[model samples]
Target: QRLLVTIALEAARVMEEGIVTDPREADVGSILAFGFAPYTGGALSYIDGIGAKLFVKIAKGLQKKYGAEFKAPKLLLDMAEKGETFYERFDPY
Candidate 1:
């Protein structure tokens, strides 16, 4: 969904921005700073566990059913299509 995509993108940005390198640290920050469900192990973990491609597909469906905000960003779509994980593309540190 939009929530997952937003988290993933934000996590990616954090990594791209050289804020952190370890995904585990990113997850902790997301949960602590953003309050991203500690039970799910942060946004990146949630997306990775649920599968980015699947999440994007579901999000696209939601976008059609809901509104523009649900629309997955191109970066997400490209990442999903290419099977690229956030950590693979970004290094916060």
Candidate 2:
């Protein structure tokens, strides 16, 4: 479960910051391209459910264990600092 969350959130961070512009697209790609489990509500939702600040902290810990690949991007850190979820911060409309 931890691995699943980590990979999913990391992919979300990647997409949110660069690969994709909208949260919906990111979530859709995770579901369509990777067949991610829908119960978690996609990767960004998983992080949002965990709280962005907590997610960053968890990602930092994961980065310690898994090297820099698990590092959260600056955008995530900023959003976390503001207590904003991905949907709230980057809503697709």
Candidate 3:
């Protein structure tokens, strides 16, 4: 679960950095190219499934245990604060 949160935070960072233009593309590509957990529907979808608020909370715990690498991106923090979801915010359509 914590690892998944980390993955979500990284995915969020990539999106925040404009490395990936769309959330669905990032999600599908990760699944097909990197074999990122298909059950959770890739990183962004997993965060959406878990909800940003909870994911951030988990990420915070992991960050405390692990290090700065677990830090949540500004995009994710903003999303959690606004109660936003990846698909809703980064609509692929």
Candidate 4:
């Protein structure tokens, strides 16, 4: 479960930071392009669902509990501290 979540989260980061321009597009692509879990609501949605702060906190725990592979990125840390979601931070509109 944790590994799956981490993969989703990192995929989200890749999209939000550079790959994709729109949050909605990323969410849609995750479903159509990767067949990601619909219930999880794609990577960004999963993070948003948990709240950025909580997501980072959980990722940090996972990092220690599992390995460095689960480490939250700097962007995540910054967003978590500032209470910004990926949509809020990366939305072009």
Candidate 5:
């Protein structure tokens, strides 16, 4: 879970910096460049597969039990709240 959050946040940060165009590209890069799990369809997909809302909820609990690093980002929270999926928003076919 920590690994998932770390990868998702890192990918988001890179995208926010305008270093990447889409989440899929970022996922691919992270997988190939950083050796992320391809079987899980990269980090973003892994998060999606786990369900962002559930991930954020678990992350929040983990944050309280652990540290701030476990806290989900505002972007993720907002995305989850609106039922807006990361892949749909970031990639959009």
Candidate 6:
């Protein structure tokens, strides 16, 4: 679970930094290139499935226990605060 949170948040951070514009591209790249957990449907999808608000809470706990590396990205925090999901916000469809 912690690992999942880390992956999701890190991916979110990458996006937040403008390293990737399309969430779908990032998701597909991670799955195809890095062999990320396919069952979770890639990192962003996993976060979306988990719900941004809940994922932020989990990430905050992990961040407190772990370190700044586990800190939730500003994009994710904003999403959580706005009650937005990746799919709903990015809307690949």
Best by lDDT: 3
lDDT of each residue in 1-93, candidate 4, tens digit only: 685566667676686468766777777677777777788787778787788888887887888988988887777778889998878877658
Sorted on lDDT, best first, the list reads: 3, 6, 4, 2, 5, 1
lDDT of 3 by residue, 1-93 (tens): 765676677789989999998998889877787678899889899999989999889888888998999899999999999999999998888
User: Which lDDT tens digits does candidate 2 get at residues 1-93?
Assistant: 556555666666676557777777777777677777788777777778888898888888888877887778878888789999878877776
Quote each prediction's TM-score.
Answer: 0.66, 0.81, 0.91, 0.81, 0.79, 0.89
Q: How many pairs in model 2 have backbone atoms within 3 A of each other, for residues 3 or more apart or on separate chains, i.e. clashes?
A: 0
RMSD of 1: 3.4
Alpha-carbon RMSD of each model: 3.4, 2.0, 1.2, 2.0, 2.0, 1.4
- Clashing pairs in model 3? none
> What residue runs in model 4 are displaced by over 4 Å at the alpha carbon?
none
Instruction: Report lDDT per candidate.
Output: 0.72, 0.76, 0.87, 0.76, 0.74, 0.83
In order, how many clashes per candidate?
Answer: 3, 0, 0, 0, 0, 0
Highest TM-score model number: 3
| Candidate closer to the true structure by lDDT (higher is better), 3 or 4 | 3
TM-score of 2: 0.81
The candidate with the higher lDDT, 1 or 3, is 3
Q: How would you encode candidate 1's per-residue C-alpha lDDT over 1-93 as one tens digit per residue?
A: 456566765775566556766788889988888878788788777767777798788777876877666666666677788887765655455
- Between candidates 4 and 5, the one scoring higher on lDDT is 4
Give the residue spans of candidate 6 off by over 4 A: none
